[model samples]
Target chain A: MIRIGIPRALLYYQYYPMWKTFFQELGAEVVLSSPTTQTMLSSGASRVVADTCLPVKVFCGHVLSLVKECDYIFIPAIRSVQRRVYNCAKFLGLPDMTKAVIPESPPILDIDIDVNKGKRVLYQAIYKLGRHFTWDPLKVRRASIAAWQAHLNYRELMSSHSLTPPQAIEKMLGSSEVEPKTHSSHSTSTQGTIAIIGHPYLLYDEHINHRLIHRLEQAGNKVLTPEMLTTEELESAIVKLVGRAYWTYEEEVVGAGGHYLESRIGGVIGIMAFGCGPDSLMMDVVRRQAARLNTTPFMSLTLEEHTAEAGVVTRLEAFLDMIYRRKRKQVEVCV
Target chain B: MKTYLGIDVGSVTTKFAVLDENNELVTNIYLPTQGKPIEMVQQGLKQIKQQLSNGADICGVATTGSARYLAGVIVGADLVKNEITSQAVAALQYIPQVQTVIEIGGQDSKIIIIRDGIVTDFGMNTVCAAGTGSFLDHQALRLNMNIEELSRRALDSQTPVRIAGRCTVFAESDMVHKQQMGHRTEDILYGLCQALVRNYLNNVGMGKDIQPPIVFQGGVAFNQAIVKALREELNNEIIVPPHHEVMGAIGAALLVHEEMVNSQNGSKFKGFEVSEIKYHTSSFECKACPNLCEIAQLSINGQVLAQWGGRCDLWERSQSR
Candidate 1:
């Protein structure tokens, strides 16, 4: 059986289960790097120069984690699904960057998922992988189709239930879900709810945000994110809210924010990194729309090396307090 | 007496400071770049112009940061310095005896070790998000707290939870686990502060002899919790000036002062009206070599001002003149 390694970064949050299922069906063992860590980050940091972005550095760390353990490491180059909607330059050059950074040349399975460039679709990308592994095209096609169907069904189920991709995979697989279950009592009624809008890379990555999600949960506030909504719902929400086309990820966030806004969510939180070209432009549009929806308080947080937690916490507390007071006044009026 | 203006257009924030003949700060503004640095600079200039004292003569201007070239063009600056020099100068001004300067911004962090008022060694962590101000900001949002309160909450903590500070993923999982284990929010927050300090010390502060008289500046310096954390971690008292956040701009302004006073040369400051000028950028991937360098060129009114991102100096020299 051919053994493959997948570093746990980038699209790993979205596509890990699908990749794992496909490889398993094909009788291949997939070795994944452990959840991102400092050791991994340091290893990657040492390997690359300082100018690379945080995501790329983390990706490099993941790649380094898999270098010695697996026969071949899979690093896909995804350009764009459509024209004018391209992935970040980092994603497009990931494979080449990895090869350049890693001194010991490990065999990389370079798969291009550039639908806009007329390269490969989801089925074709997997089918090509199947061909690379085995000469039997019929078997490869059958297995690929089955795997693709399973992935699609899985995504559909997740969308239907408004579950995150990981949550959906766990619900289907019934095992191997690493996330700890939240107890009902721990879900204390939040004084206010805040929507954290950002790409999964920035949202889920703890080092990037310094464990922001957990902190929010600990603060006893409901933290809503884009992953909790379906792509269609998110897209529709973005249209309803912004009335403008946005980058795919930004659209999901904006759409989710729209839903939150309509739900009269207490506060809106927009989280983004410094030097993020796309977010820099998209966030302004989101903020303006959020401002018009005055029923809910809104704050846009831009993170950079000089970001101070004190100021952020103050803003959040004030936002929550304002919501609490508003809710209290509304109750008083009703009474 | 002529006044000089210095603008530091960082990725996350744009800073502007005006200096008199003595290079003292007459006025300063620290504004969010919001990704439209050109617009921000223009806005900042307009605001500064309104605030300028009567009879203040505008002489020369300087621009610095990742978008220095563009900012320079917008402000019609005479000097453009990297963050290192600007920061160094700023640190020197606040504490002339300062041996080390730790500047952490929203997106990146740096450690500058100074020797006898000269920068001898420096390390920058631009690639990682672990030790950045933005990371803390994200965490603050997660805590549903304003950033200003983080330091107080951290100070109030009795027990600091042990969070994995190395990577964002592990830190998150660790935080979740700690929360499940019933750790106090304050404790968890303090633990995060420690974790961040640890990551910074391990990554950027690695292998460097950090001497005393350390000046900590940048927007993150405003976080007292981090300042305390750094003090505890380093086992040394850290100095934070009154204008810690706007040090870069202040430093740039001081440099302009030094240049003018030392050389006896006149200032080259274009007036505030230069902010109205239009600037445009165009990028083309150079296939001349396998490097496939995507050279991005910045121009004003069809005249090329600066070009960067090329691997070699091929395009740089051609655009220099």
Candidate 2:
């Protein structure tokens, strides 16, 4: 069986089940690199540019981890997830960056996921990828439809169950039992809810965000994220800024942030990469919207290779304490 | 007599405070950390023991500051909280109507915005030593005077010269240029204070709703010149509370008091004998891979307590219990 490697980094949470089902249907064994670890992070950092945000560096590390394990490392050039609004430069040039950095890398299988040219162009790209395994056109079409169904199911599971991207992926892969992975639920303050708005990569990468949702939950506060809400809810939250958002992730974060603000969740934490372009602009929009809300406490955490866990914990505790006190005060006032 | 103990182990200083059952201050100790947080905390415990004796039994203990987790493990704290919350809590206790808090420690500075006795917003300086107490300390050393004398000299300035305070490196050069241009030492010192205040406002205090009844607390609160500079900058009356140097410790104690009251179980405090428990820290360079992460292990009596501070993480972060 020809083993095709997939690094569990950027777009992995968003597109993995689709990619996995596509290749598996085409009779290729799909091998995913293990969940990100400290080894991968340091290795990735040593290979990437100094100013690159943490997720990109982590992606570099993931590629390196797959160099010796598989026949071809699949790093598709994802230019556009939707029409008009293209991916950041990092995603567009990931395959090239991987090749330039890791001289001893494996043969890379690339497919341009650009729908800007139309639906035929997208099918052509998928056909080219399928031809690497088999020359049958009908087989490729069947695999493509299956992959699309799988991707749709993956997204549906997330919203219906309020599962994080990782949890939903785990359930789909049957790597874990199809059960909701719950954290501390015995908190004294049910009103102290926190909405953590960030990209799937940052939100799910334990090595990147350091299990931030877990930390918040364990600290006697309930946690919420952008992926938990439906598209209609998220869109309605940021209807005021319809044409302003350009990036897909930015829209999700800013819209979710707007919802959390109006919902008056105890707090809204906007996690962004230190040097990310879209996230920085998105965070500014979220901050401005939060400022007007005034009822909810807002915090923006910038993640980098140099981020200190102690410092992050300190800020999180302070934010939680503040919100907790405010909620308690409101309760007292009602009495 | 029941007492609550609070220890704040910062990067530059270690502080301990004791509170009576009524939440009134009993005694406090402040000492330079000197990169030895464990020893400083133990030493602080010893001093507190001498001051209070065994007559007043410590019922609950809490830890705060940068080394809060470490101190919590060492002292067997009932509660462990971050410095920002601790500082805000202490300030609220000191001044009931305080709307803002300006906290400047040696290596860090933060501004906390409060409304109706609750913290609304906060901003912390990111990796900048400028406008912090350490920069002023460095400048004072260059002037060949102690911090107290420098504060006194700055207060005596008739005409303060303007100096840029965005970066410590730039601020030092600007001060030298002013000195070369025949500006008086007192004027230049006060000017540096004003510049630091300006930097604080621009960096840490920016975009926040800063209002009156601002309480300035931290180790740097003792500097009358900085307080005066803050007053002139904000054009609001700045009140420096008593025992400001150990406000983080005081806040921790206050929090522990609340915890002890709420809990049905007895406190987790390990007792005053922990002051004599010597801690041992061992470090070894691991060249396992190209990363070469040097792991440090902290222990008491040759038993590993916790491991941290590596180029890479050999340090598995366990869930906080």
Candidate 3:
């Protein structure tokens, strides 16, 4: 069986289920890279230029880890997921970047995905990708349908139950009984809700973020993420905040940010990679919206490869203290 | 005779404050951290112990600052709070109507927005220390002048030259260029202050509202030039409360006082004799995972008292066992 490698970084959180299902249905075994760690991040950081965003660096690291484990590495150049709504340039050049950085790696399976080119081009690209493993077009069609179903189901699980992508993916692939592992002490003592608005990669990668969601959960505060919000809700929020959304993942940052700020949540924290152009602009929009609203408290955390966890801990602790204090004051007034 | 003790162990300085039963300041001690937090904490404790009246009982203790966790473990604190909360609490206590707090410590600067005694929003400098007290200290050392002289000289400037403050490296070069250009020492010093204020406002105070009655505190509060620059930029009065340098410790002390009264628990303070406990700390690379986290251990007489710094809390939890 042809073993296909998938680096569990970048759009892995968004498209892993579909990719895994599609490859498996094509009779190819899918191998995922190991979870991120300090060594992996450092190696990835070393492979790329110093100024590249952290997620891309992490992607390089993941790709490097998979060189010995699989026959071919799948790297897609995803330009735009919506008409006129584009991805970051780094993502557009991802396949070429990986090929350039690690010339000794296995043969790469590359594809260009641009929704702005229309639906037929997108389907044709997937079909061409499928031709590598199988000759039958009917088999390819069936596999694509199955992949679509898996993707929809994965997204539904995330939105319906407020599960992080990894958690939802685990539940979908394993047993539905898989529950989000929460600390025993915090299982029943949720004091407030905190909305963390950021890209799915930054929000779910425990290593890069210093286990941000786990830390918040351990502190007895419920966490909400962009994955947990619906597309309509996010789109409507974007419309309300800036009259439109232009970035591909604007829904995750600006839309979720504007919506969360207007809601009764205790606070909103925006996390962004240090050199991500799209995130910097979108996060700024959220920050400005938070400032204008003056209702939900906002804090922005910039993630870099070499940032110490101590800085993140201090900010989180202080932000939580602010939230709890404000909640207590509100309780006092009501009483 | 009951008192609450607050210890703030920062990157550049460690401070200790003792508050009487009525929240009145009884005694305070400030000393440079000198790149040795444990020694500075012990030294500050020793100084504060000597200054306090014999019968003043330390009934509660709290710790705050970057090294709050380490200090809490060493001193047996009842609360370990972040510097932001401590600063805000202290600011609110000093000026009841304070709406904003601009605190520039040794290696960090923060702007806190408070409304109705609640911290509604706050920001800390991210991955940069260009406008902090350390930069000023660095420049002072380069110019062969003490920090006090730097402050006094900055006040005497009539025309200040603009220096780029976005990066400390650039700022130093700009200062050197201005000096060679024969600009007066006072004008150059005040220019650096103005540049730092601009950096602080643009970075830490980016999107937050800065309404007056603003309170400024922290080690950098002692710089009259920075305060004057802040006043000019905001066109609002910047209030520097009494004991601004030790406000974090005072705030920690105030928090512990409130906590002890409400919880009805005996103080967890290890006592002033904590100065003589003969504590030591060491770190090792943790090989339990690929992350290779550097774990720190605190010990007394070769017995491990606490452990921390591992990405996983394995060593930290093992200490309790």
Candidate 4:
């Protein structure tokens, strides 16, 4: 069977299930690099220039992680899902960038997805991969369709049950399809709440964020995340709070923040990967909204591989203390 | 009476300060950057307006930090300066006899050696987190200790555990190992502080003559453990100012004050109403060369204000009409 390597960055968090199902349906083996590490980061940093953002450096690290382990590494060039709503420019140049960083040339399968121009969708991207693997086009098409349907059904079932994408996939496929659960959530109280707002990939990846949910729970605070809310609810929250529509992913976070505010929560924690453009934009809007509402204290946590635990804890404690003091003052005024 | 304003628009935070004719800090505001520094500055200005005395003559304004260029454009600043010069100026203002300045911020860190109030040499570590405030914050979270309590706790330690502070991963793994080996929490915390201080001294503070009367400022100056560790490591007392975190803004404000006194320049500040303005950014790859530099263009009301991220000056030279 052909071995395909996936660098564990970027869309890997969103599309890993789809990729795995499609490749597996075609009788190929899928390999993913280990979670990001300092060695990997330093190596990747040296390979790229200083001007490149941290995410690009991380993407390079992920690519280097898979250099010696797999036959062909997959780096997709995604221009945009639709016109005027494009991914960062770095996503469009991943293949070339990875090649520039890697000392030895590894065979790279360049997958181009230009949905805006109506060039190809997810199925077509998989079909092209099937053709590259020397499989019959008709057989590949049928397998791709089955895999796509399975993926869609899996997502729907997961969302309906308020489960994570991986959880839903596992439930649909049973024991054989099980992947390690990287994130764990626990809530202590419905009244005292904090929202973990950020990209799904960063929030779900336990290794990258280092058990943030557990830490919050250990501190005796309840944590609410974006994945728990319905798509429409999230959208309406964003519209109501922001007074304008936003990009899809950012809308979810804005809506979550809105929900947190409306709930009269103690605080809202904005967690973002370092150098995330959309998160950067959302954080500003959220801060302004939080300030205007004055309902809850707000804090932002930016995570990179270099994130130090001491700084995060200090900020969290200070934020919690601020919230506690504000709540106490409100109580005293009421009394 | 003349009043001056200085703005420091960092990637993670934005600071603003107003100074009177005597260069005394009238008021200061520090806000999380939220990636919309221009908007934050406007919000800060509005807040400052509510506090300023009526009929106060504005002398001049200065902008600094990573977003200095953008801020300079937004506020119509009289002077634009880098963080190094701005920081040195603030240090000199507070500690005239200061020979060394160590500044640790959210995302980066810097060390400056000043000779007679002039910056003779300096080094900045922006590429990594080893010497930055965020690194210490992350470690505190892992240990489940309050960040503010970390410094005080370190001062109580009788034995300091040794942690590899070269990078986050090694530090974390080494910390776990030390904990497994049954080291006291306070000792481990103190060790981590020492490791970070050592790392800073070796890296950003490398190859510089760090002399006495050291002035420590920036966000991390609040960490007493770091101060203690530095004092113990270097065997010298470190001076942290009363307004440590807002020094960059203070320095920028002082610079504006100096400019107004010497140059007779009117303040170019855009005033408090700038919060209502809408700002947008658009990006395009320049095909002028094979470099294919992705250029980000910032605009307000359809007029281009600034452009950045280009390798050469090609996009900057283009008329945005």
Index of the highest-lDDT prediction: 3
How many clashes in each candidate?
34, 0, 0, 18
Ranking by TM-score: 3, 2, 4, 1
What ordering of candidates by lDDT runs from best to worst?
3, 2, 4, 1
Model 2: per-residue Cα lDDT over A1-335, one tens digit each: 88999998888878899999999999998878876777898999999878888898888888988988999989999888767776788888888888899888888899988877899999999999999999999999999999999999988898899888877887889854222344424567564678899787887776677668777876777778888888777877767755545675555688888887888567899888889998888888888878887877899988887777666777888888888888888899999
Query: lDDT per model, in order?
Result: 0.74, 0.85, 0.90, 0.74
Clashing pairs in 3: none
lDDT of 4 by residue, A193-266 (tens): 67777776676655456556656665577777776677677778877877664454665468877777677777
Weakest 10 consecutive residues of candidate 3 chain A by summed lDDT: A175-184
Write candidate 2's Cα lDDT for B31-86 as tens digits: 99999898888889888888996679888999998988788888889998988889
Worst 10 contiguous positions by lDDT, candidate 4 chain B: B312-321
What value does the lDDT take at residue B62 in candidate 3? Answer: 98
Over B134-217, each residue of candidate 1 has an lDDT whose tens digit, in order, gives 887887887789888887888888979899989877888888899999999899988998899899999888656699998999
Candidate 4 vs. true structure, TM-score: 0.50
| Candidate 3, B181-290: lDDT as tens digits | 99999999999999999999999998788999999999999999999999999999999999999999999999999999999999877877888888888899999879
* Superposition-based RMSD of candidate 1 using all C-alpha atoms, in angstroms: 25.3
Off by over 4 Å in 3: A175-185, B318-321
Alpha-carbon runs more than 4 Å astray in model 2: A176-191, A242-244, B53-55, B157-162, B177-183, B283-299, B303-321
Model 4 residue A140 CA deviation (Å) reads: 62
